[model samples]
Target chain A: MKRIVLLVAAVFAATMPAASAAGPVDITFLHAMPGPLGQALKQIVDGFNATQQEVRVRAEFAGNYDQLLQKTMAQLAAGQRPDLAQLEVSLVPRLAAGGHLLPLNPLLNMGNWQDFWPVFRRQATLASIGGTVWSIPFNNSDPVLYYNRSMFDEARIATPPATWDALLEAARGLTQPGRVTGLGLILSDIWILEGTIWSAGGEVLSDDGQHLLLDSPEALRAVDYWARAVREGTARVYPDIQSWQADFAAGRVAMGFGSIVSWRFLQPQIRFPLSVARMPYISRPAVPVGGANLAIFKDIAADQRQATWQFVEWLTEPAQQARWAGLTGYLPVRRSATTNPQYAPLLNLPATPSLKVGIDQLPFARPRPTAPGYVQVQVEMRNMLEQILLQGADPRGVVRQTVERANRILAEEATR
Target chain B: MRKARPVQDTLVLLVTAVFAAPLVWMVLTAVKSQADVYMGPLWPRSVHLENFRLAWETAPFGRYFLNSLVVASVTTASVLLTSILAAYAFARLRFAGRDWLFLLALGTLMVPGEVLLVPNFVTVKRLGWLDTYAALVVPFAASAFGIFVLRQTFRKLPVELEEAMFVDGASPWTVLWRLYVPVTLTSAAAAAIFVFLGAWNALVWPLVVTGSTAMRTVQVGLASLIYDQGYNLPVLMAAATLVALPVLLVYFAFQRLVVEAALQSGLKS
Candidate 1:
């Protein structure tokens, strides 16, 4: 028995190193990419795994952005949070304020920060939350106008609209009564509304992020344009955002406003010639940059956090970013990625015209409001817009009441 | 009255068709080509059977289905065992604080499962059960509704049955298995179906507990399909059809047990 035990101990000691060498540090990365975007993200993750031996990222699809947020919060409260997660840009304030995210300043200093676009860097910075950088930008996008070139040509229009007044003129000319609606407005999210408000020279919140500014004259003017368009039969608001995309793809709507990432899905479905253009402006060109960012949770172990940072660094490398942008329709977060030789072929695809328009508009892209209670504010804004466009509520009265309610919510959140 | 019978049958058929139309539409859409999906016709221009292949390839649905099956079956079997024992005690055994304990168990019904998500998650994490089959199956092993229904059914049985079993020198375990279980199979089957469906269709708890694709259930797998394949209605519908097929089959196979359970309970009253 003594001899057998000694032999077993020797065998166990001999094999331990082999086991440790083959087993990489395992890390979980929760994300909300769906469909083709999910596929593209998986390829990137798989690529990272194949290239490394020290870290293995287990990517879990945590539903859509809202669902991912809920899961992350619940897991954090339970003390079993993933090492890393993909968070929507708007969620930065709430997560950082709650102390759920790890500040990325130490990791960002390690040579990845300088390559990011200034816009993305600013979006990732949380000034109100002690100026700690909380996330790294990924899958960034801006809303652009998706128009049917055939419809424009049939209307005797030579070019897509460049301003709000021209948009109205184009809508009037493109409206075919029973045959085709001129514009299909998506009332589901606040991205388009933010762009409209910005174009009319209004801010969703005050500079300090403590007040609601939707009741301003600029915002009212923008909403009134939407209301008049809907009332005049030149525009229709779908019950859901996806229906607008579907109608646009089916040639039932002449123009639609959606994320530039939508090109990956919409390009193959449209039977007619599709044209992409900048979002029609009002006083000046302005659009809100929308996308998700990678946030590491604070509760993970040191080694796991290190592994996660390594994966994040690899993900943001110029070559990887170019490949990711080429596979997915999101604008490359790094400016240097566009000039990379590998991205040249991607830039020449048929979808490049629309992508170019989005890239050109990037200079004016502003981050969505990152106030603590901004999600509630978005909900109120959507409800107000829906009422004004669909129910014909007076734009001025609805905007005033909505802003008052939003301000009350923000104040309540502040006290908490 | 004879003429009214046809009209009544026609109305019932119409209602049934109305209830089944969405499922029919899903199957039809699942078989449609991408272009035909949006063409607004009930019938497809050409059937694209490849949608199922594409949907299956998109996610690890085979693993998800297997995980859901194991979780559902294990949970249902455990729920049945625990519920039967507890119900027998409540219905037949007389002990101190028996009624109070039963009431306490019943009180748990008032608290919604959603309210317990965080605390339960914490408990599971402390046990180091995250991303394990135990995390999926253990927390849901016993159900209050199952106990309540079985206890009600057991109480409705005559006391003479237990007396006879005792007089015959049978133990409590034997009495439960030989007498109570045989007579209450219908109610047990009903409880089993409820537990099975609950476990199979669960999304939030499984999604919360497991953080890897290998541990995901079919419900989570199907949800991921929506974000990735939301544009391709055919593939989305095909995946939905696959996820739902098991539950529909289970319900169809056990529906008679539910009907008989309702009838038996009614007759006892």
Candidate 2:
């Protein structure tokens, strides 16, 4: 028995170094993307691994954005952080403040950083941290108007709405009492709320990130418009994203606001001809840039960090961006990606026109508030919107209370 | 009492049916087409078995099942062994600070599992066990709840029986395995069921420790199905049905023993 044990131990010891030497450097990439987008991300990672000799990237499907944040924070506290993560843009400032993310500016040398659309570039910049670029934008998207063409035709609307007033008018025209609601708005997400505030010429946070600006008249006007719409039976707020998406796909809603990312998933399910339009503006066309960005954790080995940057840079390349945009419904972050020969066929497809509209709206896209307490603020905003839209609370009073609560939370966060 | 029998039977049937409705709905939804799902029909217009096949192909569920099986089985076996030993010492053996020590073990029941997530994760990482079966199985090997349950059952065993074994020159180990364990077999089985279910259904710890698909358990795999496939209710329901099958089978098989064990534990205590 002792001899056998000795032989087994010797064999195991001998195989250790051989295995280590033969294996590529393994790095973990945590992401929250699910479904077709997740599959597309896997393809990109597989492509990178096939061409590389040094680093093998493993794309892990961490739950959604909130779950990803929780897991990453837990891992960080445990000293077992992944080499790379895809974080929401609004979360970058908080994570960077925690000293959990590595600054990419020092490692980046190849890509034309300026090639990124101005909106994406601004969103990816961590102004609180010496204005350094901390993450590379990936799967970037903006809200657009997804209207059922058949419903629009039945309502005698010749064109999609171009302004908030026109949108309300079209919504009112499409209502069929108990049969179909005119519009479905997702009240749970802060992205749409921020976009509405911006379109109404109100900012969510001041330039210095010290105070709330939603108490302005423009912000109140936007909130009141949505509240009145809901109360007037022209629009209904769904409980969650899936509920609203299902309502639209089931022909229960005529028009809805959704991210461009919804196109790939919703296209197959909807039986009607779905048309996309730029988000209807109140004063000027402005939508907040939404989606995730690639962030490298600070604790990875230096060589692994270099390899991670290589993968990030490769993923953001014009050709790769075009491929990703084509596979997923996300907007390509690079200007040259739209003109790339490889993507020309994708751009000519019927489904690409809506994406074209999304692309055109990029110039007017705005970044979400980057306050460290912004996540909590988003919850407050959602609650306030729910109160106003669902409970018939006075819009102006709710807006004022919500802003005051947000400002207090920001103040507490500042001291921390 | 005889006249109340039919009423009791009817009430039982109604409650059982109520409890079973969601499971039946899940199975029905699993076979429904995506378009047929939202139509609010009780049954699919046409049975679409393709959702199950598509769900299986979407992720490596076979690997997830194997991972969950191995982790859960090893964890259950370890828990039984450790709990039996600890419970025997507490119930049968005379030792210094025995009561204090058992009290300490029971004290852990108050700490929520969620509060230990970060600390346990850190300890596992420090032991170089991240992404390994050791991370999933070892931290959970000795469940305090298992020890407490087994200890209660052990104390309820007739002390005269153990004394008879001792008088017959039987070793303590002999007394435990040969005499005490047999008498408390039902309780042990109940403890095993609880431990197995806990290990099988665990999500947060396994998700935190394991990053590779190769190490992910079925619960995590089922969750990932929802992230991308939330709109595809049929596929999601299919995946969920597949994940719940093994646990349901286990429960159905030992349900009589489980009920007897529960009644005995409560009555004896």
Candidate 3:
């Protein structure tokens, strides 16, 4: 037994050097992407591996977004952080501000970073720490309205609502006993609130990105509008966004706002025709840019950094981005890919008529603030909103208190 | 009494049905088409048997099942042995500051697992056990809950039997091994089941510690099966069914033993 163990150990030892020597650049790439997009990402890595011999990129799906953050933080403490991390936009500031990320500009300086879209660039280039461009946008998407076309046609609610008044009217018009709801309000989801509030010309954080602005007129109008829908029976408030999607597919909802990526997953399963449109705007046409950016960890070795950069650059290329967008509903970061012949067919899917709405809203997209305390800020805001919607509290007063508490949290961070 | 028993049984049945509703819904949906899963009636019109096959083929479940089974088994075994020894030492052995020591062990239960995550991860990394089964099993081998439960059980075991063992020239270790273990098997079984279930279903820690996909357990594998673009829900359900099957089988097989042991332990204590 000992000799066999020794023989196995000797073989493993002999192979280790060769395995280490083969890649010269094997970097651990961690991501929070689940489902088909996760598979698509692995395929992208495989493509890169096949196309080049210089780098060996290993892709890992790190569960969900929040759990990924915790995992990354733990790994950072353990000094085994990944070479590249697909961090959500909300978490970028916290990770970058902690000085755990390497600026993408250095990597971009070596290549043509301008090949990417301007909106995507802005979302990623917020100068995370000491004016450093910490990460680059990869899987950028905006929330869009997905409606069952058959239900809309039956109700004569054409063109899917473009303005807030139209949205409320259509929602009310679509409601019937033992029938579908006009809208599904995922009151428990912070992302829905962020997108809706921002569209109403409200900023989640102050202009200086230093304070919470929930009490601002824009936020107040947004909250009031949302509350009216819930109270007036135009929308059915769900406890969670996950449950809402399931309900929507069952014809429980007439219209719902969700990530464009949701369409790829949801469209395949729905029996009826689906229509997509820009998420209804109130004061202005705006949407919060969601999804994640690819970030390099500070602990990555210098040589491995180059390999990771090579993979990142290759993966974000127009062809690859277009292919990724086609496979996944996430909008391509590269502009040229939208008009690509291959993606045109995907965009023309009968169910996803307005799939491009997310990409179209990109020019008017507002990214979440890059403040260090933004994650906790959003969670607290979601909690406050849930209290108002589910528990039937006064929205205006609860929002006021939430704004105050958020500002205090922001203020504490400012001094720190 | 006979007249009331049927009513009681009916009430129990209703409660069980209410509790089992979600699991039943999940299984039914797994065997139904997309439209039938959502829009159709409660009972599926037809069962799509391929969903289970697809779900099984989607990932390396064979390997994941083995990994889960081995890790859970080892963890349960180690925890049962360690908790018994530690509990015996605390409950029966005369020691200095034993109460304080017990309090210290109990104190760890108050600290949320989230806070220790980073420290434990760093310790495991330093020990170079990442992606290995040891990473999943070792840190959790000494469970405070197990110790507490077993200690309570050990405290209630009769002192007369221990004294009789001492008179028969049995050492404290022998007494613990022969008498305490046999007497507290029920409590130990309960503890083992709890630990086994927890280890079998752990998500975040295992996902973080195990770097390689090959080393991933069923829970992580299932999550991985649901890709970001979309999930094959039928397959997801099928895989869920398969994963749940073993647990159900184990529970039903040992349920009588489990109940009898729990009753005996509670009554004796």
Winning model by TM-score: 3
**TM-scores for chain A, candidates in order?**
0.91, 0.91, 0.88
Interface RMSD of 3: 2.5
Better of 1 and 2 by lDDT: 1
Query: In what order do the candidates fall by lDDT, top score first?
Result: 1, 2, 3
Score each candidate by Cα lDDT: 0.85, 0.84, 0.80
| RMSD to the hidden true structure, all candidates | 4.4, 5.9, 5.5
lDDT of 1 by residue, A339-382 (tens): 66666675444545666777788888888778888888888988
The parts of candidate 1 lying over 4 Å away from their true place are A1-25, A106-115, A340-342, A346-353, B1-4, B158-175, B262-268
DockQ of 3: 0.50
lDDT, residue B121, candidate 3? 96
The estimated TM-scores of all candidates read: 0.91, 0.90, 0.92
DockQ category of candidate 2? acceptable
- In the predicted model 1, the residue pairs found to clash are A34-B227, A34-B228, A35-B227, A35-B228
DockQ of 2: 0.30
Which pairs clash in model 2? A35-B228
Which model scores highest in lDDT? Answer: 1
How is the predicted docking of candidate 1 categorized under the CAPRI scheme?
acceptable
